[model samples]
Target: MAETRVGGARIRYDDVGQGGPTLLFIPGWCTSRAVFRKLAPWCSTLHRTLVVDLPGHGESSLPGMDFENATVVDILRSVIDASGARQVVPVALSHGGWWALELRRQLGSRIPALVLLDWLVLEPPPAFLQAVRALQTPQWRQAREGLFSLWLQGVSSPDVIRFVQEDMGSFGEDMWKRAGREVSRAYAQYGSPLRALSALSSPVPTLHLYAQPEDSAWLDAQRSFASSHPWYQVQKLPARSHFPLLELPEEMAARIGRFIDARVDVGNPLDRLAPSPS
Candidate 1:
């Protein structure tokens, strides 16, 4: 494992395998880079793969203004710089999609490729967000345990459950509760990459992957995001849930392995997302 000190925050990251065409993975909210435990092994066998924990999420401790000012853009900058790869591909999922979008916005042409595993691309609109805020009002907060409760319900991954249990169980429920609440506050205020996505904002070659057993609503949102890109590839994993990289490791690896082997716009449909920069 390698660590990088950036913006006074220590980000824990690791590099796997050796060679050109590196893959950098960014996990979803409340999850660790360990989420890629399966995918990393497969991808590393064929290409250099880097898996990193975002600040406050996993191995890294939270900076003072962690979510207050920490944007995925800056995070990726640190990761990319540390990798020493002029062109690196980002493999993002869920909230990780926001990070990937920011990457393309600032380094569109520079990114060799992008792979989004069920990334968030479309928001429910201002009205919906406002409604959510209403739902979070004091009256509702008491009635409902919290947004974190709903979010946990949304994620149906045994692997995630086990990881959080073994890794964070000692912290007690209060610590986890506070962490989840604070993260929810940040999410409510700073989530906009979905609506911010546009061809002008992102012209990088990209891959969008979704699992069939996952939420169709989310899957539709993912497809909409890929379609909006004007140039991107979309793949639907069969018989898998939200966390196929962990749940269906072998199949997930086979899919990603095929994608990596094909290279940019050659002999691979997953190459559809990112066409060679014209």
Candidate 2:
């Protein structure tokens, strides 16, 4: 892991492999770059893979940075600029997707492609959001201390469960609060994922991988957004949880590879492989 100072944070990132069209991997909340350990190697074979531990997660340091959405976007941009990669295809997971969207917004044509893994793009029901916010009180945070381990285990693989347990255990309550606050603040400031999608003017090809137990509203929102922006496409993964990357890393990586290949290849690989539209 290499270190670079981006704002108040000392960002830690992995820049490995050699190729054009760099692939920037961003893990979800509370997850370190370790989540992409298996996936990175495969991707590195084809493109330079840059994986970063977002501020306050993994080996990264957050001197005094706050977890606002805009702040995160700025930090991410700084990291990419510092990396010296001119063009990149951002592959982000969960909360990291927000930063990816913002990157496309700010950088526009500089980003060749965008990939999202089970990202939470839709605003939950108003009732659900209200209930969730109510649970964020310090009292509730203290009460729900070990509950995440149990809930996570039910949805994720053993490896993912272990990672979450160890990560949450290391920083305890403070880290937990920071992660939650970041997501809540992002939602509050930016509105829904639909709003973010609507604001984008770039036609950069986007691939959204959504996991199972799909929310209807989320599907509808993506559909509507794609209607206006045809380059944005969504695919449902077979996994049953939000952490599909942890549940099926190899499969997910392969899917991402195919997507990137199809978009970036000089001539369409699918066109050569598929029968002539008959």
TM-score of each: 0.71, 0.82
- The residue-level lDDT of candidate 2 at 12 comes to 84
Pairs of colliding residues, candidate 1:
205-274, 206-273, 206-274, 232-273, 233-273
List, residue by residue over 161-232, the lDDT tens digit for candidate 1.
565455433333333444444435545655544444443443566666766435577666666766766556
Highest lDDT: give the candidate number: 2
Can you give the lDDT of residue 86 in candidate 1? Answer: 51
Task: Give candidate 2's TM-score.
Answer: 0.82
**Cα error of candidate 1 at position 32, Å:** 1.1
Q: List candidate 2 segments past 4 Å from native.
A: 65-67, 131-136, 140-153, 214-228, 264-278
Residue 16 lDDT, candidate 1, scale 0-100: 67
Error of 1 at 207 (Å): 1.4
Worst 10 contiguous positions by lDDT, candidate 1: 269-278
Q: Best by TM-score, which number?
A: 2
